[model samples]
Target: MDYWKSKVLPKMRLIFVKAGGKKAAAAAELVKSFDESKGEINSEFEEKKADLQPKVVEIYESVTAPVKVLIKERKKVSAIKKNSAAITKLFEDLANIEFPGAKQVSEGISKVGPALLSSPIFATFEKIAKLLPVVVEETPKEAPAATEEKKDEAAAAEEKKEEAADEEKKEEAVEDKKEEAPAAAEEAAPAATAAAEPAAEETSAAPAPEAEPEAAAPAEAESAPATAEETPKAA
Candidate 1:
């Protein structure tokens, strides 16, 4: 009785009172009530059991008497069948036996079996079995949402990477332009110097013409003296 109160009753309670939400709240309330009133409930159950004990024993004897007789007779028969190596024949012989009250016992078991299946306890156990897979299936349902979020994050990262690459390419192009500017200036400098050299040569050659005019005036003066001296020699 103590073991049933402590162990079996809690397990029975848990089958009906699941462990989540409103059910968890109800289970907690049930546990609190059990804790507060366990002594009273146990006393009441004991009184009820005492009241019904005699009838329960009578029913138990009535149900088990035939089973006990069957077991004893089966053992005796099996012992003989084992010596003959004929277990199947023993079962066939037992099936033929129609003890006076056997029909009532078989009918009682058949009625009780269906009643147990239709009971609230069995229904609660079935419900718990059904809920078991729901908890397992919940995690997989959330997985797709997380996977989609990860895919979005990866896409954003890829976009950022592409933007960074484009910026780097633009910077490289600007740097290439900057490097080419100096090379272009250096090339233009030699061309500019080559163009100025022809102008400088033209200016120097113009001054040489003016100096030649001055030399021509000096030559004219020497020629006049030579002609005057030649005329005096002829006289």
Candidate 2:
């Protein structure tokens, strides 16, 4: 058992942890892809899980069974001691092993599993199995809604831009009409002045006719003397 703990269990823990880390990394990558693709991770996620789950589970069970056996037989195999004493005894027992790389394995187990019955790694794995799937399922649901909201905002902005452009065109048309009004009035002023000039000239010529009649009366008066002389000749 000491040899197994120092040699086989440590290697098994490495394999188990590595598989778990790979699964975690793959899941994280899938989630990132899901966000980029607007919530489209279902197929890829299932494929990756299918490929990785069996291997992870196999290694997990292999490592977990031994660790659980050790934990169950801890009191019978060795007397319970303080955490520090247990770690020290475990290292001392490892030193007796004559394997090629026994020292390194011993050191690794000491670092990873100081207390075999109460290993933190075991608890952590349990938590991962329970919680990771929940996170994977629920995290992607918000992505589509967020994407739709961004699309709506973009459409609203485009509509506002179009409306602003139309308003600018209307204002330009109004300004053009305002500018044409003065030019039209200026063109009509000359024609109006020409039409009134004839009426003004007729009013000024009326007094000249009166003066002509008065001059004709003086000529008639001078002709009366000539008429008297002619009457005497006839007699």
Candidate 3:
């Protein structure tokens, strides 16, 4: 960041201030755009930086420094162009992994030649940003199980077996409770029906008094027998 601000940024401002022809004017416009976009570029770079190898980033910085020096010193255009091409080559050679995105950056630099040397570090930063997410990427993978002592292995296996047994027992208990619910409901059904029938019978018989006459007749006969005994005694 310091290098971009101190070294490359000054050069870019100079390119803009010294803008003359059409191409220079366009390049000057590009420098301003690069300056404005640096915040986004830097934020993205920071987020994905952990995946990139530091060696590659240092090498890229090295490549950018010399090109900026050559352009600042007003060295030959051919020398600046050579160093610019080297930036693209450095990334391609340093790429130790296969990835589509990194390949694209290298191919793009090969075709474009890393913009004019006087421009801001826009192309350089962008190339690094694209490569950061892919070059030497560390894919997350499940670690291998560590070796264990025979005693520990046996104990772990026993614990796993115990857990399995406990789970099976819990399942059986749940099934038993489920079965008992229906069985209890069925047992209660007969008692409820039996009690209901008696209630219905009592309700139906409550309004009827047909047995009263029979009860009265038995009492009258007892009275008559007593009367007969008294009459005999009197005679």
Give the winner by TM-score.
2
Candidate 2, superposed: residue stretches over 4 Å from native: 1-138, 207-235
Enumerate residue pairs that collide in model 1.
Answer: none
Each prediction's whole-model lDDT (CA):
0.48, 0.53, 0.60
Model 1 CA deviation exceeding 4 Å by range: 1-141, 207-235
RMSD of each: 24.1, 19.4, 19.2
* Candidate 2: residue 131 Cα off by (Å): 11
Q: Which lDDT value does model 2 have at 37?
A: 45
Candidate 3 worst ten-residue window by lDDT:
138-147
- Looking at model 1, residue 180 earns an lDDT score of 100
Write one digit per residue (lDDT tens) for candidate 2, span 1-235.
8999899999999999998776556545543432454323234334455454444444334444434344334433233233445444433442443212223334534543333323322222332243222226546789999999999999999999999999999999999999999999999999899989998999887764457778988899989988988999999
In model 3, what lDDT does residue 17 have?
A: 68
Give per-residue CA lDDT, model 3, range 1-235, as digits (tens).
9999999999988887675454555555555665676677556556656655465445546565664444235435566456666656654754444222344445544543445523443344344544433445443442222334666798999999999999999999999999999999999999999999999999988966579889999999999999988997887
